[model samples]
Target: MSVLLESRVNGANLYRRGKVRDVYEAGGDKLVIVASDRLSAFDVVLPTPIPDKGKVLTKLSSFWFGKTEKIVPNHVITTDLRRFPKAFRDVRSLNGRAVLVKHCERINIECVARGYISGSAWTEYKALGTVAGETLPAALLESEQLPEPIFTPATKAESGHDQNITRAQLAGLIGTDLARELQRLTLELYRFAHDYAASKGLILADTKFEFGFHDGKLVVIDEVLTPDSSRYWDAEVYRPGAAPASFDKQYVRDFLVQSGWNKEPPAPPLPPEVVRGTSERYRECYRRLVGKALS
Candidate 1:
């Protein structure tokens, strides 16, 4: 399988290189997003590119954007190659791995929703008996379902880790009214996606959403519920006290944690087996959630 570690579109002006997606400034208000096969673990982009990973991310995000559009407006312009400009359509490598979206001013907040106690939230709970400054009921085991989903927002850091902040701080940063509006949209989208995943025999442990303003209205932007942005667990094998089997990047994360490499730049290259395993897990997620194999 061919892998696009980096994109080189002929006519597009390259601007931003996100962890996974390459953002190119197309003419006017349009942006060409190329989802590279780059995999970022521990917030570090690994040297190896996973085969078909970028296609999976682009396809899965398109699948989800279709499902949740009624929940909120989104920045998607069109994924149809025929609809894209010639500069993008002429590049055959961009097929199924790129999207043209309307550019909008980002809200600069990571709106996260946790349906289960796990990940960084679990770490925070173990230390301070709270998740994001909100105290939780005592004796909650790891991976246990929260009494109810909580809207936890974090700073949208350009580099390194994003800091978990309180709702009050979120309001202070992005106005009280917009903060409340984003909180409402985030939880609604999460619950809707969570229930859908449950019916498909998967658990959406937690997920982060990004939003931006387009034409004076808040709209969902960037990637939606892909493996990189969400924690997906197998529902059949889920247990409250232990980490459940996941079909997301957890496979890569566990390997990196045990590989004895310091979590910093100059990250070690992933072994072939690790690369293949991670690729399969990402494909499995698209198959399960989208109900079809990635094209």
Candidate 2:
């Protein structure tokens, strides 16, 4: 399969090119979101494009948006390319890799929910007995389950890593009412997804969500519950005291850390093995979660 690192829709006006997706404005209050095969680690886009990666991501997000829509409204208008605007409709390359969604005023907060302590949460808990400055039980292990899922909000940084913020701080940034709604929705979505993944022999360790204002109502925007936005681990092999196998970009992050490349722009290219392994991991994640092959 061909890797699409950059999408060329020819006539669609470019909205913005994110680390992994290229968005373009369709007519009316809609946008076409194209998931590219480009993978980003530590907020830095890698040069190598993983084959069929974009299709997996696009289809998986659509799968999840359908599953979780009853829990909350979302921005998706259609995932079917035939229904897209005239310019985007006939592009064969856009078949499974692009979605048409309503344009919304994005809420700049990254709504995070953690069922397990790991990553930055673990680092902070180990050092200061807190996750996002909120205290947790004493002596939690690296990947141990939390007492319950907690909602941790973060800033949506334009570049580099998003910074975790306390719930109260989130309230301060946004109004108290809006912050509470985001927390409620984030935790609820996480719980629903967590339970679903558990039955499928996977752990929904933690995940983040983005929301936006559309037609004067709040709705989930961007991608949801995909490996790119969530952390997953195999249920049978999961251990509390150690770093579990990741079904996300954490695999690539581990490689970068070992390669001793300072986290900076101009990131190093992946080796052949790394590229193939990463591609396999993304595909496997799709297969397990969506209950079908991404093809």
Give the top-scoring candidate (lDDT): 1
Per residue, candidate 1 scores C-alpha lDDT tens digits across 122-156 of: 99999999999999999999999999999999998
- lDDT of candidates 1 onward, in order: 0.91, 0.91
Candidate 2: list runs displaced more than 4 Å: none
Q: What is the lDDT of residue 79 in candidate 2?
A: 92
For residues 105-124, write the lDDT of model 2, one tens digit per residue: 99999999999999989999
Candidate 2, poorest ten consecutive residues by summed lDDT: 245-254
TM-score of 2: 0.98
Which lDDT value does model 1 have at 245? 69
lDDT, candidate 2, residue 54?
A: 87
